[model samples]
Target chain A: MLRKLTVLAAAVGLAFVATSALAASTKEEPVAPSAPWSFDGPFGTYDQAQLQRGYKVYREVCSSCHSMNLLAFRNLGDKGGPFWDPKYKSSVENGYVKAIAKDYQIADIDRDTGDAIKRPGTPADHFVAPFANEAAARASNGGALPPDMSLLARAREGGPDYIYSIVTGYHPAPAGLTVPAGKFYNPYMQGDLSSFWKGDPNKVPVGGFIAMPPPLADGKVSFDDKSPSDLKAEARDVSAFLMWAADPKMEERKQTGLAVMIFLLVFSGILYASYRTLWRNIDHH
Target chain B: MTAHTTYEPKTAIERWLDTRLPIVRLGAEVLEFPTPKNLNYWWTFGGILSFCLATQIVTGIVLAMHYQAGGASAFLSVEQGIMRDVNYGWLIRGIHANGASMFFIAVYIHMFRGMYYGSYKAPRELLWLLGCVIYLLMMATAFMGYVLPWGQMSFWGAKVITNLLGAFPIIGKPITTLLWGGFAVDDPTLNRFFSLHYLLPFLIAAVVALHIWALHVPGNNNPTGVEVKSKADTVPFHPYYTVKDGFAIGVFLILFAVFIFYEPDALGHADNFIAANPLVTPAHIVPEWYFLPFYAILRAIPDKLSGVIAMFGAIAMLFALPWLNTSKVKSMRYRPTSKVYFLVFVVVCLILGWCGAQLPDDAVIPALGKTGINLIDSDLNSYVWLSRIATAYYFAYFLLITPILGLRETPLPVPDSISKPVLAGEAAKKD
Candidate 1:
């Protein structure tokens, strides 16, 4: 009888343990992580000239389908400008302008017709999406909405490196590699046949393989009195411009961080000296 | 230093591990003996819960390495991780994704153990309250984390939850805008949520430390519903409880590993696979399964504002449980009548969870006409009446039965000794 009771007690104890264990299992689901790419250290900072060229690439080609609606026209004239030089602010203002009506409605109009109503071209304007509606947009672009490019440089898995790689890394299809209809493949994407020919498979560019067709062509847009630049350089420059657009304050943030650190160090030294004097008499007591 | 000439380890690796993980031997020391004489297995949950938390933190850090914060790329970044990049990025992502479900699973068990053992009674009330705060923070963190993916479910879930704020009085619209960071849930909202979601877990860890600290002060309540009276009744936590907790944690990990490796997406919504769209809404909107009971409470009310308030109120009411249940008795083992009611309460909660998952039309009508509760104007009358009945029963279990049972019900005569109870019943019959 004693043995039976002991067995029963043990069984009940095991059951409770099992139930509790099962309950703990419920809490084990993993949360997805945010922002995998490292923006710090050695690989940081894009070249300024590359950014200037990338801006031109954007203006000439990618801007047709994508919108930088979050950016102000005047912002292009700031020091280390993402789009244009400081002297060209007036020209940029004259080139594209937004007019607000009496009732706070913003209208973009033709420069020729002073009274003509127009869509907004200001930083505050909602982006003019590529498609009119979901159905129409999908129908036009093989079911993929050409996403807004305003934050694309910062938003993808690889940050700026991904954008740079995708733009400059496109190549002609290798022998025996079949391209899917309406889908343009980038050779630098991992797992693609051209990925092997591009060099070591281990070093494919960031943001993984892309399906967007190549946007730049040799001498597609040219600047007069140019001091030797290739289409690849132009592509790299445009990507840098997009990166600045995505995070205009990044450089300023780094500078501010350094200033704060210096101030903290100086303040700590003063405080430490004050503490030493204040505690000096206490030790003798 | 003068008396003892100790030889230092020459290797850098030895020095590092020795300093950082000095408790390795201590961990083994704790895992070697018998637990307190009266300690039932309910004590095992706290250790298991800690194990799950560690898993989440580790996996969360790895996932953060690849995640993108912006609206445009957040969804696609996850897809890239699954399709390319990093050797076992997919496995890591899957484990982290499923680890959330496992974390909640452990907490619920930890919570229910507290409830069943009356761990929340008397001195432990503050501990339970801290636990409730932890639960609330965890829910917020999970909800915000889900939005980072920017999938169909993420978009709609944000919309639905944010819109709930609009049900408030005059200031509702402004509050909703403030919460969304704009006219609608957009880039600003995503950025801010990412920042907060990243921050809240650290806060949760801090609160959990307090929760455990509170538990230690009163020590642990046991199954006998009696306080420790002597040295014979109690045991030191190490050696005895450590081994028991270790064994329980091992079993828990096996189940967690199964979900991580085999059926990673089993608990997730399929709609989340699609990228977010503002214009389109999915056919159904359901919250994570762990939230189903409260979700049911929300839908149970016919009015939008009332429904919102009622759902929140259900959770808030748990705070008053210690004062409301004037039960002298701690465990259900002693209270015969209350035991049956507690079982029924569990069943009701399960039913509510099931109903929460189904379409509103499929909610059980409770045989309304036969019950003679007249439905004069609307079909909603039936639902309202049924919900009121269920809600009444739920409250009554706490307020009336608990206090009444404590005052009036005849409790089973408790054994004087823990071992005696086990030996008394069966041993006599065998003789």
Candidate 2:
């Protein structure tokens, strides 16, 4: 009985060591990117006009489905303006949207009838949704839940570039390509086994495709002649605007990080010197 | 001691370091202990475990700087930190997350080393108990830390564990509600858990100090079961053990760096990437890998209270181990038969961990279908049977086998003298 127990113990130990060794030996494979089409470029530095165009696209098309719940309406006129151009701040004050205050009261309008007065738009007022609830919204758009765009630029894998590409990538179907049913296909999206395909080769970029059909038609939004004035250019402009919306303080953070790094470098030198001075006499007999 | 009798001019820096870092002398004394000559690589795990603990504390502090504990802002704050906050904030968070896994890896090895060398026996029982306490505290700390991120896994994981309290016959729902700080896990629960997670590491550190103190009292138990009989039996710990432990720490740090730099998120759950959504439930829910063994024990019981008791009992049982074993023998080296039982116990533990990771239904089919026997109708019931059997074996190794084997088993011949020369002479004469 003792011998049997001893053997059993040894076998268990051997098994554990062997299994651990096996686990150690099998190297894990690298994870592939979940989204295939990515925008590759430096994140910072975008043209001012492009941002203006993006705001227009967002206001007209994207705003119907997405809500930037965290943003206050009045913030549009801030230094980095989405509602007003910095160069033409005066034009913003006289624009169609203006702040107004009113009191609720019924007064005689023509001696025979009295009516409650109506109020104008205010900076404090939030953008009203087209649908009352999620069910109503879904009923209008084939049951697909539209994600909030407040942080969409940051949440996605490729930040602004992915958004830009997805917007401009939409086109009619090309020759020799068959798209399946129920699934809207994007040629650029790797690992997408979806069958729905739409896009013409002339309209779409070689590696670009998106489920969202072309949102910007040619000459839809006018920009300065030097700026990207086409639909594709407008798509890129709006993507940049969304990126800024997602992280308004990004530039400030980067600047602060640089300053802190410099301070740490100087501080660490002093600390190292002090540490050496403190330890200098420790070896004495 | 007299070698430094002659006064010599000291460098200014050396004097300054000595004044500020006074603990260096005590550290030197610890490093210089006269360890048994037979000490090997396994003994290095204790030092490596300490290193991991220190790493965790530093990284955890950095992560806490940007982390918001309130449910309203917690998930958003983490995302902001990853996307736009401090530079390399994502890397820092990932390192801390993976560091918890690595710390467990080291402690498990350290604990196993103690068991294998019979370091928990006799005078060192308190040390072993201290270690077990540290392990328990570590589990609680890690569990709470996971919830602080407020991701999908974080929310669901917290809900599932807290709900386990509801399994109790009378006080279950009330207890769970109290734990959650409301009807469900929300801002209040997250806040309290964050506070506790921050506090527990220090508690663990204190226990670890006690563990080391206990260890020093009895010294380390080496591979050989024989006690030190003469001056030749051990070497002074200073230069000898210090260099060995230092070298081992360096090697261990290299491995730690590989994980930290190259594959920081390898150990983390993918579901944690998505923000917490109360409306959407993940298809599969599982605890972190480190908790798998106890999770298996929890699943074993059919009754809610019994399962809770059994899970807690599994850990509590370890405390009574020193007293429970009937075996007189301290080390497996001297007990040929008992060693086999010890190995079998280790396998059972690994099997339980693997089973815990599997879905309950998948685990049940094999047990019933393969054997063509229905010992229990529910998979959980079978798990309970398996755990009970394993738990029985675990205690039996200590309570029954050790004392019994010590008295009955004929041990291999042991050398009488510590010196190799003496043993050599004896061998020559026999030839």
Q: Could you say which candidate leads in TM-score?
A: 2
Which regions in candidate 1 have their CA more than 4 angstroms from the true location?
A: A1-285, B1-35, B363-389, B417-423, B426-431
- Predicted complexes: DockQ each: 0.02, 0.04
Predicted candidate 2 versus true structure: per-residue lDDT over A112-175, tens digit per residue: 4555443444544444455667688767666655656766776554456667656655545565
For A134-221, candidate 1 gives per-residue lDDT tens digits of: 5675676676566566557654434456665666666665444456676655644544244424555544333223446677777876
Docking class of 1: incorrect
What tens-digit string does per-residue lDDT give for candidate 1 at B62-150? Answer: 77888887888887677544323345666667667777777777777677667776878988899989989988998988888888888
Each prediction's TM-score versus the true structure: 0.57, 0.61
